[model samples]
Target: MQGNSEVLVIDDHMKRKQQVELLLQFIGEPCKLVSSANIGEVLTEQVAWRAVVVGQVDIGSPFELVSQLAGQYKAQPFLLIGELGDCVADLPNVIGSVLEPFSHSQMTQMLHRCQDYHLKAPSKTKPTSQHQEILFRSLIGRSGGIQQVRQLIEQVAVTEANVLVLGDSGTGKEVVARNIHYMSARRSGPFVPVNCGAIPPDLLESELFGHEKGAFTGAISARKGRFEMAQGGTLFLDEIGDMPLNMQVKLLRVLQERCFERVGGSTSIDADVRIVAATHRNLEGMIDKGDFREDLFYRLNVFPIEMPSLSERREDVPLLMQELIERLASDHKVTIRLTERALDSLMEHTWPGNVRELANLVERLVILFPNGLIDVNDLPSKYRHVDAPEYDHEYDESLLEQDMLNDVFQNDVYEPPESSMSTQLPPEGLNLKEMMTELEIDMINQALETTDWVVSRAADLLGMRRTTLVEKMRKYSLSKDSA
Candidate 1:
């Protein structure tokens, strides 16, 4: 018998089971076939199976069949043998099923289909030895948007043009900024990071430009600011939109003349540093409202690079989670392995906080499920609603269809209600209207924040027809900030 060699023929009719087994044997996939009408009896078995030939009559209670199969062989692949509408589409572990009274060719085809499903199953795709080693370092991507970001980094890193990395918080803007600097001529120089929004206004001036002794109350000694210390290197200014107006003037001067001076010193020091600024704010909108300088906006925006959010690249979630799990395990000296179901749960979450949130969750899971196999039960109660499977935006039509079919055949026949259509798991108790309001507000704010309140780009972020998002913006009584 092949390693995964077991089959269950579920039907009330014993004769039908015999007929199907004979057909399966003729197809050269002979295996032990158990026929039972009672699902409880079938699932109670402690054996592993590759496929289940369920009859059309048995699909009304698909989970009984799924429960029987999945309970023991949840990881094992499934091929349903039944008529359309007969096999429940929501059954778990089912790869694909066929209509009943199958033909010889159909039996052979179903066998091949099951094999294909098994091959593509998550377990089979576990990272290779070399891949596992470099998984974390690979920048986690399985989507076109991310691929484009990586390509841009590779393309722009070789040039000396200043780059403005744009994205929401936790979207890896700094990572992209760093990659650009390292890939450029400044690789040998130190990469200094300064959070523009975090530093106080008065101090920020002296921090970036340095200060001569006796310049301010604490200026007991002359100190080299970030610009001088980062000379011949790259200076990453994070959250640049929050810099005070006066500071923006000095920054614009430095960018324009490529030279600046200490707060109290007259000597103009050469600012030989490459500027890579990023923000979760919309500088353009600030400029339009006269809060930011238009000239400064034009200067820093010479080469803009937008980072895609984790939701936009859901395909990479599993790979990224696995990578994070391994790294966390190694770091904390733990041996952690996720059950197939647990991994699925993690992938299903929307991750509004993006990669940073995912990383935190993985670390938490490690502490929670160390040594033991991390199964679906290990997942928090918020994730266990059977009706609401988690939704992943990154999944394509094929994967979604497959997931739907899997959900049909695997579960005990329950579906979530009153939640968003794309959601897979049950609700996390968020009120629908409130959630929509929040989502709308976030998208609008994020768009305005990123595009500097450029209506067209903000519209793009909301994914609504631009006009529609604008209408909603007016309808929802929302703004970047309240009056």
Candidate 2:
């Protein structure tokens, strides 16, 4: 209860100030109460404050002021006393709020929450140069969704709890995992990433847990698996839902026991690495279908973070595009500029593949139009129109029939053309399958052409998954060069 501990209050209204003082006394805490009518005056004082409470009359923009102060004092808790709707309580640093004319219980509750938050908050420390760079590069957006994700990462990075990143493919789940690792106490350790979906089901076990020499026919030498390589660090399991059911059980056991034995090796190894799993697939759905283990799901779902889709954070598209373009220019030495209209077109499109789709488009544009300016018309046809589908049909059968009857009655004409519906087929007969295949190929080729062979975008235009499009391309043996 107190020596140097103090609560800073900012309220121009005398009555509100007295009420806050009364609440502090009622709480029976011996902390000093510092009152200020001006925010500038309170900020100038070099005092270590435990908490800050700002009322409506203290500043024109109470939420903005609180946000600024919260950033300055990361360990200090902030409370806004104003109209409920006027305060933005969603901010990460804001512990709670006390509405005007608050009751004794409400005021006491808010004070307790603030004090608790201040005690639990992490101490502010300057990040190293490497950490700063990693943090900046890993997350690159000012959108609310991205900001919230950043806040969540900051809150959970210090803990050793498992994190499950949920998002559509290309939403930067791995990036988030990396940020968490670098920001955590394990920053000096290795950060290994494994794509569970890309690895073969048979080989995945050995890849994760390692296989001793002579474990299988082709086991030439002993090799450390991802888990071993990620000791004292973080192991990012990308596309964890794609992991086999048997592997899930093994993984669950490893997680529960925190130890694992290599294939064909009886000696168990300590699993010291942190687990950060990511997936585009719905693991819950897989669990319901008995494809994924329920126990394993609960194990990885301890601290779940859902990444917002590109469509959900479209406002960040322009910034993301610029960052991608700059990165491309630096890495590939290719420069490309998008006109205002072209930028607008990109922002308007529904990015199904998220940031990965956007980055691919930027790279493709740079390659196609090196050191050139791209306009709205230069964008893919899908970007130019709201409806990207190639086929559209509108039928009015009644009008067509009426027109036919009118022609018969008014003109007394009853002539049917040689190519009428009944006699449209040629004497040699049409190869329906071949014709349809050709049409399909042509449309696919067109989609590919427009998207510059970016499979995900092309699939979006063709109304299919990227994998489905790839399969069709393989079926047709179509490549960008061939197209």
Candidate 3:
């Protein structure tokens, strides 16, 4: 609690300031970096704030500072930047070391570890997701529907309830399941996901419960199924409604008896894994049509969470787009900026594919444009709901480059606008400070608008300290929602 920074560099003489910025650039993670500044707010702010508070033993209270903030934000890790000492050896938060010269390898290692340690558990759970597809660990939305989904995830995560997430395809059912797994006590264990629909019916049984050698035509070697692999962790069964009725009965038996035998093997293996199933289809309807087992439906529906589609929470589009863009930027090192009209058009569209469609669209645009500024006309034909001007073939990149310069200093930034006014003063002299203040406020507002009022991003755009931006916002009474 003494003096803390987001990446606090304690009273350092060994190149503390410049090194932290370089380290972050190498890692390619977007985070606010501060050097030897205030740490008071960082400790009390959101638990997701990530950075290494570099402290030296001989410096003014770096150890005490890290020690205090360590417990509160365990997920927010640290990289001690100094000579190796036994004093910080036991601190659970000090995950890496930075020598006097600031090694890039050490910084990257810390980030990779932190990604595995992403908000507790973000390790890719096999075929469920790509290894590099590290996404927003926390759901990015402030809408009522998203809030309810988050509440359901939190409530069921700690308990041993079998969760059934029901929603249309691409409504983030897998995202919900992953969150539940990460938040549970079995976080340290594997998260194995099996898509019941994707697998052939003939192989569904083998996929879920494993098979002994020569059990089937292709079973030349013994193989462990999802259930065995997910021992001591969560097993996610996606597209449960699409599962064959015959397979459903077997799944129900395993759920009920909590044990199963591998194919062509008599000995039973304890099904110690937790069950978290999801489906875009309605099981009740399937049961009525005699395509699903009533018993299986009841078994998996112990604690059901209904995910809201993207159309239900249109207010969250900006935030979601921001996160998707950030993820794309981090993963592919390319970015596309959407004009206000284009963003408005997107929010108005009824997203049948839900968040998945939006993600794909963003990625596509980034791929096609890279660092281009996208107007409404620049979007796909189907996405253009509003009347936009004809796409100009000869596009100017200066405006976008300027905006990028405003943002991405730490992330977003605002450039002082070039004055159209002359050097000669009018007969009635003006207050230069007041005029400059007005210009600053106008640019800050523009920056906020550009980033959808993401304060950290806006601060980055303005090329100023986040703390400074907050003070300016306070001084001018600027509010994102109100503005």
Candidate 4:
């Protein structure tokens, strides 16, 4: 509690209890200490606590108070003050305890977490109807198809129904599954994704359903598979249409029974897992061809979700490009900008590989032209719909330089000189930062030399602020004597 909002605290010790009270008062937060008598009234009240601070005198049972509160209110965020008692890891919502003497920063940070929980707390009767921006950020589009996909994802995420995502390759099926998992009741649980097509046909069963010790020659020790890994969470089965016919029967049984046994193990292991399966291929067509079992199809296709291809939602390309670029920039520590013409050209060309293809192209451009502006001509030949001027194209040769120079100052028609830059990159990748640094140094040197080392004149020639040039000069340790 960092404000007037009341926070519930369960502390048996008097000294620690007084200290907590002082700290809460210092932070301008009101706290209600729950004792044995008023525990019922405190919980039964129609007020939402900022958070519950747990401080038990008995180290023997650190989770005793937590268990009691959790029983009463399952969603209450518990902050373990002073000691991170044993079994704290078992509970996902438990915040780490403060050290012996709780510092202002640490206490405030923990309380801030409680405040966040309060802001995003779900409704008691139903799963949170509020569309958290962070949760649905992956589904970025204003088109009817993408909106419908998002609506469907939101609708199905709150329920226990198995999701079947149908789409073309690279339509972000796995993304949908993830949103569902994070938005569902089992959000704290793991999110395990397994590509059904990637694993070998013979090894598929062992990959999904764990193999016991001595189950097979490779099974040196017992190993938990995806199903076990995602016990309380969602297990994303990608390319479900590609699962072997024999494996499909086993999966169908597990889905129906809500339990399974490890390979070569008799005892049934409860699979408290939610299944979200995706497939680009036509399952109905596969069933007609006798490649897929109809019974299994029915089991998985409970909540059907269809993802729109890139072509279907071409309007989202610009937004997708921006999102992908920002993500990749953070990853690579560099960025690229796409011009309107470039975006228009990309939109014109049909995306056969969908969003995945667009992501790849954005990544490629970031690598090729780091911190540079991109135009239609800079795109690959296959992706390019617009062309740049060629050297062979007929134009006035003698007056070209003078005419262009006049056009630049008069008409403000200056554009990047594509011909001046290297037409081809090396087979072995070039160092973009190093190359840029060297070019900057050379340009600066030329500007300084031409301007007779006059800092202001040189800065003007470079089209940069005098202070910026001075900083750069200092960074490079440049001096007139050295020059």
Candidate 5:
């Protein structure tokens, strides 16, 4: 087989080669099958093949041919046709094994697996400076907090140390991980991101590590897992705090030994990949609560980077809004502009969801105003009170305190008190309970204003649960219109 044949079958026995060819035809996939008697002859030819099927008898050694082909063409997947006892199923690039005298269904399934592997293979092309620039531009911000994150990324991108990104949800943890991968030496390799919380616990093992054919029910054919796909690349374990305790132990072993066996296979394959895990959950707290393994925590926290929330870097809001608007316009063709007052209102509000919330609001505005200008009046009601001053019941007392301190310092008209409580009180004593209530109300109002009356987000800002925040709002009789 030479040139552009999609499938190559190598078997020294003419009858076996013919049977393989007929099986390929029976599958009804439009692939040209090239039969070869010698591995040497096939290796000498120049061809781009989707997959290769090699018989054990043709190569004398059980796995030598498969290993050689895997080393030569790392992108190409191999299906070994041999007896169950002599199968070479442990190789990194070997997709599966079809036993001798295999049924037609087995041959069809193996061929399909090979095609899936070929399609999912990462591109080998090197990224250009322009591509890197685009990725950098996606992280738009000029505030000190964001600049520090950028500097931290620059400092750590060239190293092989495992990274642990800590931040609240919607703070762009995955974006940071991708930036590190693209800026590192493994830029050309695959960057596979897996959400640990999204997958079911039962299937997560097979999802991370390959499983042998018939290893479990519904596992029709052997498959190369994420680790194999991410070889020489990076594996981003997003929401890793949600990983089960059992899986955490297995993950720790892989990190320590740099090798892992497939779900049902005995051979251990080297994990030639960097690990970058991120989570919005508080892992340290989880460890203290006995939900997370402390040893695993230390292993992943070797090089930690914290992402700043939107409220922490409010100065970058305008720049972020501009970049987000441009991106939306270019990507979705839904352009819109915010008036200065509208921008000011957005900047004043606290962003509990951070950049993600801003992005969502921008998209919503784009859809509502489409290629138009959004003024302050266009804003939702929750954000309309940004210009209003907070109600402070202690304002008079604060002014009195400032005046008394000024009198003492500038006019030298005040005498020192004999004791801490010796100074005479005002005509009326302070109502401590009323003052406390006022302070609580002010804080709740601020949280509501910042989050645009999103109770869940406001609760996050106040370090409380959504239900508790709702209860407090009811006690204070607070409403979006009132705030």
Candidate 6:
């Protein structure tokens, strides 16, 4: 084990040196090891004692003598011996000393200290109050919550297990997904995302597993799904809980087998993709109700990482706001600032929508206050008047208040035409029924616009929850297809 220098092992019993060397290597250390049978060898290799381990030097001279030798080297080396009584009194202050018959824990701790002695510079991002966003350009938080997330990201980046991200919509699940991909060993490869809930059940199969030409009426040519596209990279599944039960079974098989085949293709294809799935639903409850697959749950549950809600980490609000301000200013080519009062107003509100909602608010404020800084007055009337958005729909309030009623109870369901309405409303007026339909459409459109066309966000803006929004979308036959 000897190489360049000597780690003076002072003991008549040569077996002790072997014990120490074994301990050092077990702890992932690469050090030149040496053994000396006598004090004469200690003096010969005393210069090398700059990094020394004196074992059982407790019998003859006072402990101060070994201490003096350590002091001469400007490295007060410690002594590890079979018994304390073996040493003459007056041992100098050694880094650490322990009696022999030491437990594995005690030995390991000593080895760690030795490794710390040879410290090197850390080659990673530093801990700072201002955390970076997914782009690594924009800052995220000036508060404690975001900082904690950053810390967790650092801790988990090097692992090769699947990550399950749990957070409400618009809380930057995709942003977290990107960060994980970038931080992992596969950073150089692509990051492909599949919104499981957004796509139709029939198409979602092809969207994830690819499709051969002639597989379906619309399949004019062969196309790769998200898994194939993200080969040797990362495949992020957004809203994974929304996937059909059958698809979940197939997904579980792919995860277990790491292989799949395109629709209408006989040959199997390898899916060498790291998976990161996100969902807002209570998956455990879903699993209990037989809505989600148990095997798939276990497979994806390898590494469950629950993202902290925005309200839980309020300290980062200011930093996130500033970053949003700068980003919006750059994106739309407008300079905007937040007044102290406006900033205070932001801090005072509970962020149910999390970072995404805040970013939208900032963008809105920037657009609304182009001439100057935004004050409390510039904030939306909803935030000013109440924490929750006002529900102005024509549904019966009494029905909504009923204990047995569902989250959203639909009255008269209407499906829009295949051709979506224009981004601009129609100029031609219609009869009462058509007008009511048009007004409802207008409200949905406004919600989408105000929330930046994010369906879940639009739902929040419309004073309904995300699940309700999806249901309403089905009833009205609306889709992002128009966008």
Clashes within 3 Å, all models in order: 27, 0, 18, 0, 1, 4
Report model 1's TM-score to 2 decimal places.
Answer: 0.53
Per TM-score, the best of the predicted structures is 3
Pairs that clash in candidate 5 = 350-450
TM-score of each: 0.53, 0.54, 0.60, 0.56, 0.54, 0.52
Q: Mind giving the per-residue lDDT tens digits that candidate 4 earns over 195-293?
A: 999999988998998889999898999988899999999999999999999999999899989999989898899999999999999999999999999
Candidate 5 Cα outliers beyond 4 Å, as residue runs: 1-138, 387-483
Alpha carbon lDDT at 180, candidate 5: 88
Q: Is candidate 1 or candidate 6 better by lDDT?
A: 1
Q: After superposition, how far is residue 309 of candidate 4 from its true place, in Å?
A: 0.7
Task: For each candidate in turn, give its C-alpha RMSD to the true structure in angstroms.
Answer: 19.8, 22.4, 10.9, 21.8, 28.4, 27.0
Model 4 error, position 132 (Å): 2.4
How would you encode candidate 2's per-residue C-alpha lDDT over 84-144 as one tens digit per residue?
3434556665778786444433554565555446444444422222222233332555456
Greater-lDDT candidate between 4 and 5: 4
- Model 5 residue 137 lDDT score: 33
Candidate 3: what lDDT?
A: 0.70
Overall local distance difference test of candidate 2? 0.71
Model 5 scores a TM of 0.54
Hey, what RMSD does candidate 4 come out at?
21.8
Residues 1-483, candidate 1: write the lDDT tens digits.
123344556766667666666555433244554545465554443433456666645345544555455545554556655542333455555656666435443454465445445544564432111112111232655456876776677677767788888888888888777777765778679899999999988799999989999998988999999999899899999999898999999899999899999999999899889999998888888988888889888898988988877877655665576557556655787745554345555555677888888777777777776754555666777645223355443545333323322322232322334563567545666577676667657657767878876555665565443334544565676555661
Candidate 3 per-residue C-alpha lDDT over 308-342 given as tens digits, one digit per residue, 9 for 90 to 100: 99998775675577668767777888876776457
* Model 5 agreement with the true structure over 252-346: per-residue lDDT tens digits: 99999999988889988999999999998989899989999999999999899999998976656766776677667768877776544466577
The alpha-carbon deviation from the true structure for residue 220 of candidate 4, after best TM-score superposition, in angstroms, is 1.4
Better of 1 and 3 by lDDT: 3
In order of TM-score, best first, we have: 3, 4, 2, 5, 1, 6
Candidate 3 residues lying further than 4 Å off, grouped into runs, are 1-138, 390-483
Clashing residue pairs, candidate 4? none
